[model samples]
Target: MPIDRLADLADAATAPRLVVKVGSSLLVGPGGTVRGEWLDSLVRELAQARARGQEVIVVSSGAIALGAARLGLAKGGRGSLADAQAAAAVGQIALASLWAERLAAHDIPAAQLLVTLEDLEDRRRYLNAAATLARLLKAGAIPVINENDSVATAEIRFGDNDRLAARVAQAASAHAIVLLSDVDGLYDRDPKDPAAQRLARVEGVTDEVHAMATGASSSGMGSGGMTSKLQAAEIAERAGIALAIVNGTHTAPLARGLSGEGIGTLFLPRRRDGARKAWLGGRQRMHGVLVVDPGCAAALGRGGSLLATGITAVEGDFGRGDPVAVRDGDGRTLAQGLAEYTAAEIERIKGRRSEEIEALLGYAPRAAVIHRDQLVLL
Candidate 1:
């Protein structure tokens, strides 16, 4: 069936978990100063959301802008990567301090989190980060998360934050994601067009929807434009998480938008898999390929582990923990999994039974080439 239309966010009031992403435009003003009044009002609404039994997680972008201002750096464009990192190191303290102070006014405790792409790319680290966020929420503290720009390069960028927020929503098990944007909602044409109109609802972020988004953010203070927000909606939708792209300039926008009033474009969730499995399947980077015989391919199809005996060949110099693609003897991609052993190690055990693995390597890391838990068939 064709994706017809999305339901309004009217039910957002009852969602148990809400992840709100505020861009630098909403957090910083001219001269790189923090928007204290705006932040305070937003936090008040967040506090009220908590009182109404909602767990609000904020993904904010402003460290670089605020940092550049503090360091007396040039405006309008970013400096070298190292210079940006240095600015981030200094600016993060100020950002955290501001959020802490503002949330404190409502007697709400806030936890500061700094993360990079690697944190979500690696499975073990992903689990650890997810657990910490879950724990913080359980303790009734709102997590104020931002990219660790001090060390990240292209990964923690402005255009990336929108997608990062979507991943955070999935990892944290958020029921909804709200992207507070410079614009109220998506439009069918260039927003500058006199006839251009905002789209109030989006069913699925198909290729057609993406083509509607054009132009980069012209705001020197921000990078997340309509294109990035649409990309974010695609990610959030597949994770079965509702997302809203609403203007952030208004006071208490979070509260008003969540109550399902007509404010911005709301992209409803489309659950694909259990959150962890979906992350593993869609987010991880593959380093190599493991070619197996038909017997092994059939086993995987039957939901069995990938055994050394079934593997016909191992290609690449990947480490034990690196992700790899699994292929059948016919050279068709079968699945993807984290290698239990290095590519060199797998070379030695190819076509050997699980029992022979210990003798071949002198150390057996279980029997499966890739444990069932770590494998996801394509």
Candidate 2:
């Protein structure tokens, strides 16, 4: 793809979804101040993209930096884990408020989601988070996601938001991710060296590529450097999401980069399995079983969702969002999917109409026992 065609990667007709990652250096200024003017420019670009029919999700980093500043911690200092956590606890609120205020200026509602690595590791929690993001996008609100730094221990945290942004792209089923950074893009050698050259595009994040990455961040506010950005590219590639690294220190950086102004490095996706189907197909365990009738089996074969009306029996103690096997009356597994309701809930609604679900479950009913989008055939 030519540098001039970069914008097409985010075209609504072609991609439809995008994830933009704003690092701490871009969002927060010296002494914990929010970079209001810069943020307003970025927010306008986001709003324009949204108006063009793109569903955008933002993964922002600034909580720890803001928190540390509030606590009067020295800049660039590696404080104790407790200090970092306490700082994150206080800074998260300020960070969220900044985003909310800026985005609101464009009449774009912002919803904040704080997550730790564990949230993505757990199947149920992952599904729930993904579902919430999907619903938020559908409702025309942009979700502003950040790591749950306040509670995340060193061992349980992402430490940086680059890789976290890639995971968010996967969860949100985004087509491409734009990483707004201090540097323009990847370079052949030290960017400071006169002989160094910038690479316009990266084919893949191979060993040689990893070797070129520098581990330390020049800006103390952000933990991510080129190394973490490369790791994030690798994650996005495997998930079939394109990743772009570009300089965002200037006004309208996103608009310039996406406009194909020859400003960054674009990493193409090697696959197209960036949805829940891939994860569902690769799961090693099925927590429960749903025995459906012949009619339901036929319906599933035609790509229809599993409805309570077709369920003859439910087995195991699977909770909502747990992966389960869909079986027939003779006990042959027909497919596998995440349950919309728990085993007990399905048991109570088996062979019942969709309309009768509210009466049985004592709540507003879901349309399917297992939605087709969440199901995968064996």
Candidate 3:
């Protein structure tokens, strides 16, 4: 597909609410130096978008890279976990300041948010983060978001900002996402090969698409590669959000891409409604699973809530309001929803009538194990 066929970015038809991710290679130079001129150009474009009534959020990655430079660590070197944490601690402030300084030049307010994986996984925290971003956009402020690497461990961290940007798109209910990367876009083969061809548009990310992913970024300053971008593309597809990968090696990449230069790969969204349902369905991990009987499954299929009487068993320890998979006796995942009761509470009350719940745990109970409004059938 030709890039010119797409609507202009300044036109809301293209993307009313957009999230642009700038990688370390594009924002930070050797010796941890900030790329001021490059950022200035990007900011100019973003400011223009805002003036035209388009809301924009920037998910940036460069704190660790800059911190490594400040600590005198070699480029692309992430020492021990502790060392990386320390570097983040130092670099985050610098990264935030750099963004603020650049954005201020355009009379744009910059807001910084450091998020951990748990922030988006926990239901309450996720809502809070979403609300915060929405409010910032409402106030005409551009948020500069990043993963909270200083306190996040390997187990609870989004190792790269690509996936984090996708999560941000979900949180903000963004129309589109743009990843300003070192490479222009996904290629049919290794980008280094002269015969390689860049794909202009992708409807979905499949196994063959995954196979086309090359390797970790060669820049050494960033952790994400083609694989990470594809993972992000999958998330965006499920969430009904279009995503594009454009080269950020030069200034005004966003403008250049929107100018119909055929410079990037654009992944069209699969669906646009039910953003919340898409989010629940796209979750890669669930805290627990609830296995219901056939009768319960039938009731759920009929748009009914999951009553305790229908649940036969529960697996995994999870707190109230945590996401859980709903399965039937056949072990087929029927849906995913927020649980009303703790795993232990559910275990004690399984198979009991909803009205009899007062006696089972000595307290009045809610109507269902999972409410129809909260559930997303898979």
Among these predictions, the greatest lDDT belongs to: 3
Candidate-wise lDDT, in order: 0.79, 0.83, 0.85
lDDT of 2 by residue, 86-112 (tens): 888898899889889888988999999
Runs in model 2 lying further than 4 Å from the true structure:
1-5, 76-78, 273-378
Query: Comparing candidate 1 with candidate 2, which one achieves the higher TM-score?
Result: 1
For model 1, the stretches where C-alpha displacement exceeds 4 angstroms are 1-13, 155-159, 281-321, 324-378
lDDT of 1 by residue, 1-378 (tens): 222222233234446788889888889888898888888889888887788677889998888888888998876226677777877888889999888988888888989988887887777787888899999999989899998888886743434578789878888988778888877788888888989888888877776788889757756577667888877776677667778888788887765555535567778655565665667665635789999988889999999999988888888899987889999878887788788899999999989987878888898557687998888765
Separately for all candidates shown, the number of backbone clashes (residues 3 or more apart, or on different chains) is 1, 0, 0
Cα error, residue 246 of model 3, in Å, equals: 0.9
Residue-level error in angstroms, candidate 1, position 71: 0.9
**What TM value does model 1 have?**
0.76
Which is the leading candidate under TM-score?
Answer: 3
Q: Report residue 35 deviation for candidate 3 (angstroms).
A: 2.2
